[model samples]
Target: MGRLPEAPLLLLVVTVSFLTGPDVHAGKILVFPVDGSHWVNMNLLIQNLHAKGHEVTVVRTATSWYVKEHAPHYRSITVTLPQAIVIEEEEFFVNFLMKMLEIKKEGVSPIGFMKFYWEMLNALSNIHQQASRLGVEILENRTLLQSIRDSRFDVVLLDPGLPVGVLVAHELKLPTVFNVRWITSGEGHFVVAPSPTSYVPTSGFAATDKMCFSERVKNMLFYFLNTCIDKLVVCPHYDRLVDKYFGPDVKFYHLLQGADIWLMRVDFVFEFPRPTMPNVAYIGGFQCKPSIPLSPELEEFVQSSGDHGFILMSLGTLVKGLPTEITSEIAAAFAQLPQKVIWRHTGERPGNLGNNTLLVKWMPQNDLLGHPKVKAFVAHGGTNGVYESIYHGVPVIGIPLLFDQFENVLRLEARGAARAVDATALTRQNFLEAVQDVLHNPSYRSNMRRLSALHRDQPLRPLDTAVYWIEFVMRHKGAAHLRTESYKMPWYSYYSVDVCCFLLAVLLILKAAVVGSVWFVCFRLCRRRKPKQE
Candidate 1:
């Protein structure tokens, strides 16, 4: 046959590939957000997946009072446990451990140490057992599993903070991906596989990796011991259930180790010093939907603020317990500013009020940020709030308190998008200066706008990318190639230097054995000759 023109041949191949591409027949995906704000970006993904003609179902758990306060109107299937059950269980164990550490620090006798070990292990085991039992009860009785089966879901997308959802994904023999919204020391950051580099220090806390060798060893030992306790007390129950539902040989870590992909709420540009993993993708600021309308009150708050726009102060949901000193410093800063300030103060304010400052129990954060009258965000750098500020191209003064907040703020500072002022170091003077810098300075706003462009410049919206990958997992049965090699490599192998040393030791042992045998044989022959002469 005569050769076709290059353009026609290329077109024919492209047409065929497009028609037979892997994503054409994506399977049904069930997405369950453990908490509601997690639902914000997740819902967008679910909506996009449905729009893309893929089968997607979202199973949600409803508000605890916490969720109600922060994420009202979020869709979920509500269920109630006894009040404070999880918190009580968690606190008791936390206190017990704290006490144990105190006693150890005081220096226990050998006998006392042994006794303490036993008591601590037993208590920890019991706590895990209780949590596991509760997990089992919920999974079996809650109709969550049944709903997944009814939907005939081929895969489950889950948030690991909701352990039950992780457990259900295991039971169903479904490929799973994690949508991580925050940083967890235990699980590492969502988009990046666990790395020592991802460990960032909180303001009052010491650096995670800067510990002395002995301290690192001790922490590693504690982690190891804790994992053993969890494996002993908790994992068996879930693993057994998974085996019963799926197959005899399937394991819980297989699901954890097999996490197909992670759609992290982190943008690489914003989180410097981040570790990368192929199975993980950075899609931070995914939660910030564009140009959403603002409520009238927020609009009015913006409009009433004269020529200079207002500043936004929100400490986020977790740290409602703002220290009086911090609050006073903030109030002092507001008093000097020409701008109006909106503060999301959770509790009753002491009689101190500046005329320019407005204290609200809650203000619509996204709405306020979107407003043109908002000049800067004075924030705690919670991932959601930080991302939102960047999304709106507003300058920030980050007063980070905990978790990855310090690191997030540090990255923003490095980007010139924000400044990280230590909450503890905040004096009334410094606070005012920082606020003025963010507001009056063009550099901070210019930096923020640059990042905002980079954050928004994805070929696909974060939601679409997230949804495409969820469907990708369904289409490829987990795209096992996309899985990181780190998952397969043992710790020894991952640090190749250690592996090489180990191999050298083994070779030395073999060499020593051969040398010793030859020497012994020669000595024996020499001894035999001497004896005969005698």
Candidate 2:
């Protein structure tokens, strides 16, 4: 019997070896960078993927600095679109519709209807451009796609902001992985684009359920308007393309939902608790990787500061050159601080800078955070900066400008790792108070160090986790199981109360019908009994 089974045994051994062997499924990944944030995030992903033994080719919008920095040695292709096309405009309409649909309690009005009509037309023009750009991206990248298919891409890492990447992901049948560089509303609308924040809930913007009457009504209308755009405009456009290749039954969002992974730049520790889909993985600290050496000027600046130390100030790249009133107040705040203020000011150094204060246009941020003399950080609380500070265990004084800054600061404050100063209502007193609170408070520093330990103490670095999961999705044929199926539920399905209310309404209808029938029967009986007298 043992000798007779030799062939089967050999087959079993071969199957086991094939299943467990190293490099069983070597595959390539297509990376896209449609914006500055995309460029940076994608560049880092490329580096990590390359290090983890995966082949990568980058496709990006032209003139990206990240291409210069990281992907210099790798092959890079640019997305081509006409100048008239704008993606943000489509985003606005998509946002407006979503907000309108989310809050059904507060209905729409005549003025709102008129405003929505104008916005919808404007949004329609944008959608036309977006569809046009997507077509152009396909045409330009046709040869590139052919090459990727020839080489065999197991999965596509797409930037969801751009329609081109999603279109390509669908075309290739490779599992798509989304990398979000900005804070997305739990609903997925980006807050940075020219749209009302009412529909989308991110860290800084207030959630829909919590808004006042007027704002809630306004946002609800916008959400309804956005839902129409998503259905009529975005969904239809995607459906036409997807159905052309994937068959008529396939939906655009369904295909997107089937994506392998969604790596959001968010920390639950820093954000509010909202129900999340399984496929949506929050790898927020990806940008918090330890870095190369600091710039010579920044290193020297830190070294020059004595035992009193320095307070570092910066408002991200976009809003660096702010209004004069704000700058004056910031300067005033610096003038009051006991510590030396090494400001990364993008404008001229004010004549009234404190004796201890020094102004420089730019500094290597991570390097500055790593400096022993850097006592506190004043940042816009951009995800990148917050994580960098957290990575180095430095307390932060947040002056949030817009978007999720408030949320970021709130999270930090809740954790006792930072203090917040509102940029909109900023004054010298508030600025000075925040600075003192961050620098002088031992609790902030202690909590920061504790969180830094938890963040840094991961079995593998965030980059490694990101790269590994991406390849895992590719190797597994598609990590379809990791995707959240919650999208199948309609807008109403998200709320359990809605489901209960629906059941309750059905019960009430049945009860009322039964009671009416009983009453009718009783009346008929009474008429039959008294028929002669009538």
Q: Best-fitting candidate, measured by lDDT? A: 1
Alpha-carbon shift of residue 375 in model 2 (angstroms): 1.7
User: For model 2, how does the per-residue alpha-carbon lDDT over 1-534 read when each residue is reduced to its tens digit?
Assistant: 447588898999988988885453456887755554345666777776776567777765443434552344356556544653343233332355344333222457878766766675566546445544554566456786687678677788866655456667766777778777442122352321223444344333444334676766666665666556556655565566666666867666666555667777666555544555656666777877556676676666656666888888887654444455667888888887767777777754554567777777777777777877889998877778888888889999887654456667767887889888755567888888778877777999999998888777666676766776787687787777766565566757744678899899999999999999999999999999898777
Candidate 1 per-residue lDDT over residues 265-300, each given as its tens digit: 778657645456777766787768665666787667
For model 2, the local distance difference test gives 0.66
Q: CA lDDT, every prediction?
A: 0.67, 0.66
Tell how far residue 5 is off in model 2, in angstroms.
37
- Root-mean-square deviation (CA) per prediction: 8.1, 8.7
Model 1 lDDT, residue 248, Cα: 68
* Candidate 2 clash figure, as a count: 18
Q: Estimate each model's TM-score.
A: 0.71, 0.74
